[model samples]
Target: MSSVELREGLVVVAKGIVCVVTKFTSLDNISVISQKEGKRFIVPFDEIEFFPAVTDEGVALIAPELDELARNASDDEITLAESRFDVIGRYSCGEISLAEALVTLEMSRSNFYRLKKNYSEEIGMLSLLRYNRGNSKGALKLTDVVERYIQESIDEVYSGSSASISKVWSDVEAKCISSGNPLPSMTAVRKRIKMRDEKELYKKKHGADAASQKHDARPGKKIFSRPLERVQMDHTLVDVILVDNVRRQPLGRPWLTVIIDQYTRVILGYYLSLHSPSAVSVSSAIYHAALPKFSFLQKLGVDVERYPYYGVPEIIHMDNAKEFRSKKFESACIRNKIKPEWRPIGKKHYGGHVERLIGTFMTGKVHFLPGTTFSNVVKRRGHNSDKASALTFKEFTKWFVKEVCIYHGRKHSELGCSPGSKWAEYFGAGGDAPMHPPIVSNPFKFKLDFMPEVTRSVSPQGIEFKKCFYWDAALRLHVGKAAVMIKYDPFSLGTIWAYLDGEYLPVHFSDVTKSDFSLEEYHAQKMQGRGEGHTPAGGLEDRSLAEYVHENKELVKRSQSETRRARKAEAARSEYLSSQREESNEIDVPVDKTDKADRPNYSRRATPFKGKNYD
Candidate 1:
């Protein structure tokens, strides 16, 4: 009847009922079995309406125009789809166990099975792309009145009490009846309670410390056989206190975020700052890990010949810090083919490699610094870290790099060779035939992809960040538009990249003559209430921010501690920007002073919410 081909195992509708095509008895007739009943029958091909297949397991199915639709999807959507496809691909290749796949994908057993089946049967990437935007089947379907009633009852009845589920459900039902709302079943009440976080539930029922004790466990270590296969990331406050760059006064201890290759025990990358660890620190470390480090070392003036460690890791193991759990970091990892694996709640041993490496560094080398605080209070009691502070932030950074080089060359007890030797054994010209993992081709674009992003409206005047306006001739057409996604280098405040249409257009300070300044310096000046040069047009006055900082000697002397800390942070920012500039020739991202011609003519992957209004 229809020109569409009919073959065995193909799903189609026959006589208003869903069925699987068994065979074409002849050109004029086809045999089919009812999907629900398994009853076989032959029907005339002409009599069949040739129903278009549209549903799968009660979910609406999309047509197979996948390629065009996929290309049209936002960058985030495409990245997420590819990530799901990668999980399924790994499972199919037998590279990861099904259990590991389930954990990595963060999918339930049944959900993962359905995804695998759909991926295997149809367009893999398309199937992984979620077309449904509503709640899945079996989700709680209670009205607001019932939900509120249950919540109130739970707060009044079960919280801080050893009440059983049945008791709580009975109380919730009674409350629902009294509230004049439809009563939910015991199963629904249990499911609602189960939907809550286990830690929250435990804390509400028992206590906060009890919940922590329950979740904290020391599990065995995980071993990997290849470099970059399972990298571990963690952050710690440096044991030693440091001084400022200019004044060399005692500053507070800085935070350090480190990433290490578990297989080779080699340090991949690190970020240091006076501020505590945040999403920015984690992102910078990841960006650093994926970039070629030869230029970075040369710029630092470190004498190390090779630190050949850079790639999109297969799995990044991390603790349950909020920074590691940020949607931005997770999205970046998935986009780059990295599987983020959190250490099981309470399983400290899972991150042993990086932990031990940090410990060795701090105890073995850092404790010898002039302002060392040592490891514990007992050891640090007489140190007076602030009074004994000696090294400036720059000096400390150079010394840290030298220590890292030294650490890489020493023999490891477990491997019976140095980390550098192990790295070369696997990736060098000989050894076990080198394994070349994916290298980050465009380091600058890679950094932008992982950098912090914020949404702001484009005013006729320009885009404002930290009370500073950035504008460009190209942004004039985009004025009056809202939710222009922007990415900025924290180290440099004079320029920012605005996502317009599809590409990141670099916008500079409205006053192009002003010198670039670090965010830390700006905040420090603002906090001191010294550099408030306001113009009549609700803008900053035309003055050199650098000059203002230089003239504020009294303020710096009055707030020595805070100024020293700020200077240390600014120094870190300066070094970071320096490394970035050194590697700019390897990528297409334009530097400050946008000439349009020098800018990279590339479009970022579109995000799914491209059309949504930020207002």
Candidate 2:
């Protein structure tokens, strides 16, 4: 047999069968174990064909079949070739004589002694597979001239230069000849470059952002142990144009804020509005999520048999949007005992649940509606969305409610059941459902508790806020006193709650006639008048009661039209409040009746009294 170079543990094809080399025998024969048959055979080294080098794609193409065989192979069969070391170890410990062990194992004495000599030299399995195992080699073959040339070429490539491999090779050859050194082959240079990791190469060619997005490790899907363990909330602009209720003219697109339960993949609550997202939108969605939704469905005319979801989640996952990270949002979460978890910056996929929900709703349902934008500019080509708009804001809201109900009943891809059904399974059906956290007893009080707060002094003209005066019978006793903390809802300037004594007292606009407008609408109207150079003059505190009366006279006609709308809204509010009271068994307490004549006042004031400056 020809003297072929071979080593132990080197994988090769022997007689057309895939096998790994085991050992060398005294007669210069080689032992190899077949991967598929798990059998050992001794043959000449010339019978083995070493594995050929292939590209990554070629390796992947044949990986499955090889992987299956490797997975199914028994552990003992795979490690059986290493057993000879165990025998050698035992004999060295005086367990048996070398001759006796060799005889029992049916091996020649020369082969046994050679194996012992290789083991004693501390050669590892991989070292044994190498061609020149343990041979002393000279220092690295690359001359200093070639090393400097290669380094400079790599630095140039990494500096955003568009130098090709051939160009680098040409430059390196030129530098080598000038220094009187033998020119290196292009193949050697290419091999060195391929050793660098993909991330580093991408960073050199593109940028850090591209490299991070391509190579950063991401977390896998999280499994929540129970319902309401974590909830994700986000906002997206709906992909459909809306029309005005009265004029039937196309308004701009509206925004939708959705909150989803991570465990059940159910939509806990959502809010839709023509205005952009803000702290108010987030608060509205969270408040609705914490309360039972049967009343809301009835108001929307949805005839769903049951809506089971309602909870104060343990944790709320959110992106780093300004509205979500604001102090008001943080304070609300802290007060409700809910943990706020902000996803890492630049990693929006952490809140993938809500993001996916938005995409699905917009692409699947909204795209089919009139005046749909079709999600992207490419899909929306040649479509006149604004002109095609036919549904008014009110109509769109009703349609949206119906769609949500349908979605609740539809089966989810991963959950294998409807969101509503899953919710029922987690918390039982009908009367046996697991007890959830109780809904807020008073809806008005609940809104006040979560609203943003501001401090205002009680002047003789009543509590002044945003250039408007709010007063109640309770404010008479607080006038000329220190400043008191008051909380107001941005959505409704109709009423505010002042923290006085030890309780929150409901305060209404002194001129009940102007109480129908929202803070947003009030500002909008003022801005409209200011555009025509009719801005209100004088400081808020400097205006006289007569001037205020005159201003009220000028707005009387607009207020009359507002009054009719307010009445309709008031009826709806009454119905909602009645439902909340019945469900929670709570009663509204009168502010005046909450006081006791014999009780001593222990409430802290903003400023100390003249006779008693209590700290």
Candidate 2 segments whose C-alpha is farther than 4 A from its true place: 1-220, 303-308, 429-446, 454-471, 477-485, 489-494, 509-615
TM-scores for all predictions: 0.48, 0.53
Whole-model Cα lDDT per candidate?
0.76, 0.73
lDDT of 1 by residue, 485-508 (tens): 989865567789999989999999
Q: Which residue pairs collide, candidate 1?
A: 74-606, 75-606, 217-346
Write down the TM-score for model 2: 0.53
For model 2, the run of ten residues with the poorest summed lDDT: 121-130
Q: In every candidate, how many clashes are there?
A: 3, 0
Model 1 misplaced regions, further than 4 Å: 1-221, 435-437, 457-462, 466-469, 480-482, 491-495, 509-615
